[model samples]
Target: MSTLVQLVLAMLTGGAFSTIVHAVMNRRRSNAEAAQIIAEAAASLVGPLNERLGQHEQRIQVLEAENAHKTTLLDEAIGFIRDLLAWAGRLLPGERTPDIPDTLRDELQL
Candidate 1:
């Protein structure tokens, strides 16, 4: 009877140990799988994300170039209008409009 009890106790202890080890192994495998899935997902996103970023960079460059061109044209238009204003001021009867400021002349290279 004592031997029988000891046998049963041994079996229970072995089963418990095996269960704990199995649980630990399963948890490790799950963690590894989760990490792999996340890595794969990030890897999948990299290509499209980089492509979109490149496209945005190109669009930004185009917009910057257009802005620069428009700014140049606007500056020229402003210079022309200033010159016209100076010419018109000379013909007017009232006090002559002040000459273009030296700063504006220097900036416009007029």
Candidate 2:
């Protein structure tokens, strides 16, 4: 009777230990699966976001190049206007010279 009771108790203990181990393993597997799902979602987002960033960089480069071209054209136009003004100053008669009087010329040393 004593040996039979010992055997039954041993069997029950072994069964309980196996059940606990199996539950722990199942929980670990579920956690691993959840981690895999999150990693895949993050990877999927990376591709499109990287593509958009590349496109934006290219657009910025194009706009900068266009702005540089416009600035050069504007500089050239301003230089041309300055040259024309200088030429006009040399060609046109001065107001004081045309209005000078003989008496004032001798007094003012014109």
Candidate 3:
């Protein structure tokens, strides 16, 4: 009877040990899968955000270049208009508008 009881105890202990080990292995596998999923999600999100950020930077550069060109053009136009107005003011009231002044052509950087 004692031997029979020992046998049953031994079987239960072996089953319990195997169950614990199996549970631990399953948990490890699940954790690895979770980590992989997290890494993939991060990579996916980062890839597009990085691409968009690059595109935005390029767009900003283009806009800045356009602004500079516009500013230069506006400055030239303002300078020309000011010179023309000053030259016109110098004319006699009834004088026909004179030919475009040499000073204006000379001063124009274009």
Candidate 4:
């Protein structure tokens, strides 16, 4: 029940109880070392993984910018085509200009 009683019982067992205690302690130490090794491995892998993620984000931003520029060029081309169609109609006889939608008129400020 008490510490002294336990020690006396262990001593009467010809040191077998001490050997079991030593094995249990050694196993606990081994498990702790294994956990430390896993933590270190995870720490070593994180830096390069984070760097790759940052590079991928930057590449995505550059692609988005290029897409936006292309979209702007296509919008300008559409406006130019609309203007050319209207001018061609004006130069002809009784040709009415194409009716532009209000959404396009507001967006292109035409």
Name the best candidate (by lDDT): 4
The candidates, ranked best first by lDDT, are 4, 1, 3, 2
Model 1, residue 68: distance off in Å is: 1.2
Expressed as tens digits, the lDDT of each residue in 62-85 for candidate 1 is 999999999999888888877777
Cα lDDT computed for each candidate against the true fold: 0.78, 0.72, 0.76, 0.80
Query: Looking at candidate 2, what is the lDDT of residue 61?
Result: 100
lDDT of 3: 0.76
Output candidate 1 Cα RMSD.
8.7
Residue lDDT tens for model 4, 1-110 = 34575577588875688667667777999999999999999989998999999999999999999999999998997789777876777688488667777767765454
* Candidate achieving higher TM-score, 2 or 4: 2
Cα deviation of 20, candidate 4, in Å: 1.3
lDDT, candidate 2, at 33: 100
RMSD of each: 8.7, 13.7, 9.8, 6.9
Cα lDDT, model 1, residue 7: 57
lDDT by residue (1-110, candidate 3, tens digit) is: 24465456558786575556666767999999999999999999999999999999999999999999999997888697777756776765556654556766555533
Candidate 1 Cα lDDT to native: 0.78
TM-score each candidate.
0.63, 0.67, 0.63, 0.67
